[model samples]
Target: MVFYIIGAIILVGVIAYVAVNHIPKKLHWILSIILLATAGYLLFLINNSIMEPLRFNTEKQIRYTEVIKKLKVIRDAQVAHKTVTGDYTKSGEDLIKFIDTAEFAITQTRNVLVKQKRGLITVDIEKRVVDTIGHEPVRAMFAGKDYKNMLKIASNNNIKFIFSVDEIQKFGNLTEPVFEVKVDKKIVLTGLTDYLIRQELEAATGDEVRGEFISVGSLNEVSENGNWPPYYDKADKNLNKK
Candidate 1:
């Protein structure tokens, strides 16, 4: 609508200029050129302001599709494991632990292993060094207990509290007092998983990973772009792929 209005205004101005020039025969050619240029500049402004974000959204959609594809691959692998084990049941954390072990193996060879991460609020308990880092939401083992102070007190006692991913799996309840451990080098450990868990967080959350898609995207993008592309693969042309 605005574009049409602007174009109509320019057309009116041009017609007026022509009529006045014929009557007065005094209008300069430079003034006509200036008016034409001003109209063109307005069009350029509209394109940059209105059209660029649309382009950006197109790029975002493409990147999101790729994320979903990779996530599906990871999910298929997890389903395969469950099929073999005859356990159609496992909590999100157990699946992550399984993948964590596998990720560890891949890193030993210094290979690029992609995984998805999802944030969930859970209590972590170990020997008492419970601080939550990574994408997971951290909370206190006891409802009335202050998790921060608990961790601080535990650390002072030289007790290493393990983040309670394991206990949560066993007890089948996040409400059970679980110790949170800040896994060192989360970037590294997150990618590592045992043989039992094939694809790290990808298997753990599946599409639920959608919640933290932005953060996972940020980390992966940084890693892929900040470092050289994989030796066997081409560099990603999509700037938003991370």
Candidate 2:
């Protein structure tokens, strides 16, 4: 639309400049002024149309990066929970409590060779042995973490992220556990301009995005996958692959 308007303005400017040469001096001045005003309005429209998407995408990148960070934290916490409980939990409160108060056994193992003496000969055999070395608290595992802020969206503190876990029956009637953490795009993109939000939704819908929620893990399967593009990983080398 902006391009079309600018093209029309230029065409009109050319025609007006040519026609004004045959008009009286006062009429020429009026027509030139009108053309300049139209050109100024077209410039404003051009700038607006060009800048709006750039601004939207910039803010989207910033907000999505923070959202991915939070999702990674959630993924780590869920993985730890599963490590201790054999399955993930659906409650953020329970997850936070587990993070704060759980303990996991740390085992020490060593490979040893057993030697047996029989009269004047010795036979050596290799074996593995395991021992309970110690236990470490989950909080210690995640020391220096800000537990209070883990479940909230960064842009809008009021909106807590959504987390869920489920058990699904896989092949041969075997069951497996899966977990998912999610936040609404609107929640993460809060404080952005309304125009940007609408554009985001429209683009998402056009692309057939599954939900308004950006998420990691699968509720329908036993996969710990995230809903991010390949380019996202390419862009952020330090991003956790949990």
Candidate 3:
């Protein structure tokens, strides 16, 4: 928009100057051709300046959508693993295999009378006992979803997601299991304009996908949510609505 305004001002100034100076008739066509070329160049700049960012944003959303979908799949699979094994798995192949062949142990809990030792005293106490009654296939929970490629990044095949697991202290007493699966923004935004990618990297707000990674879960915390803005999820829902 600014470029259009500036171009218009410069063009008007050139035309006024030419008419005031009264250039030769032979030179009039030359000036006209030059003006026409200048106008065409300005239009090109206007188009490019307006369209380049749009193009960048469009591609960014496309890549982010696919990446978020895969990240969600990974997160669910990890959650299922933790439910069954009491901890998250770091290996993608192991997670897939577990999902394919493992069964969830369905159990029932009942109160039973048992002897408990407390402070050198033995007393009869009612305790809860859980018994496995049946089994449900783990694969059944992941029906119609893709887990085999949960480790692979959908946007860029050259770089897969990097995941790790650890234990963190919560409330300075409880040790909780933690995991994080992440990919560098550069890898996800590969082939994009360097300056724009740098801008995104430097961003530090929730308004955009700010930071060095487009990741889910956390090694420092126990969250299973992605770091992207809510609009990404809304965008996915909107696309599905269509």
Candidate 4:
């Protein structure tokens, strides 16, 4: 509504100028030149206001694209870390190891405090817990497709990762009884986290999936108890079956 009012005012002003342009025949050339220059200047100002925002958006989009690209590296590293350490999650240090310079163009800033968690993985935007896409082959799903914005792919697809500052914590410290990861204190799986776990479970099972997560706070609980799941050696069995 405001925009419409502003546009209407501009239109009215233009029409008024055109009407007045016809009144003075003796100074018509000077009047025409002044009107044209005024119009051009207005257009330049409008263009700067409009295009500057668009250019900023484009630059931000590019940066987010780089983030998603580096996220692939983080995901792959998490998978490998799980394979060796028997933990499906990655710590803050693990993520730093995975992130390259192209992602943020600087060494990662570490913040163990809860408030800083949102800023850890996120460069310019707020942290978002991405939807779980499971372990589907990216080549089969998203390889050839062009994503105009990284948020679409991260929000809609099978990328089983959370963009959080807690991911920057050291792995060994994650399960310490006297310590806690910033985001894991509640032992509650958010809608997004539950969704991610479910995707992972379904992929491990090689069966039809009904939901997204399996054990909601198993790790946080286990950490408190100072014991690993008895099924650690049988994670495949645990993750596969209902």
Best by lDDT: 3
If the candidates were sorted by their lDDT against the true structure, best first, what order would they fall in? 3, 2, 4, 1
Pairs of residues clashing in candidate 4: 91-167, 92-167, 92-168, 92-169, 93-168, 133-158, 133-159, 198-212, 198-213
User: lDDT of candidate 1 vs native?
Assistant: 0.35
Model 1 segments more than 4 A misplaced: 1-27, 82-242
Better of 1 and 4 by lDDT: 4
| lDDT: worst 10-residue window of model 3 | 1-10
Candidate-wise lDDT, in order: 0.35, 0.76, 0.84, 0.38
Per-residue lDDT tens digits of candidate 1, residues 83-132? 33433223334444444332211111223434434466444333323332
Question: What's the residue-level lDDT of 150 in candidate 1?
Answer: 27
Tens-place lDDT digits, model 4, residues 1-242: 23644664586477558757665666667766766766776666667656755564454334334333434344444444443444544354543443221121122343342333354563343444434333432223233323223222332343333332122334766542111222121122223234333433344343321123212222333322111223332533665585
- 82-139 per-residue lDDT for model 2 (tens digits): 9998999898888889988898889988999999887899999888999988889988
Measured over all alpha carbons after superposition, the RMSD of each candidate to the real structure, in angstroms, is 21.5, 6.2, 4.0, 23.4
* Deviation of model 4 at 109, angstroms: 43
Question: Across residues 53-152, which tens digit of lDDT does each residue of candidate 3 receive?
Answer: 7888899888877888888888888998998999998887888899988889999999999988899899999989999999999989888788887777
Candidate 2 Cα outliers beyond 4 Å, as residue runs: 1-25, 109-131, 190-199, 202-211, 230-242
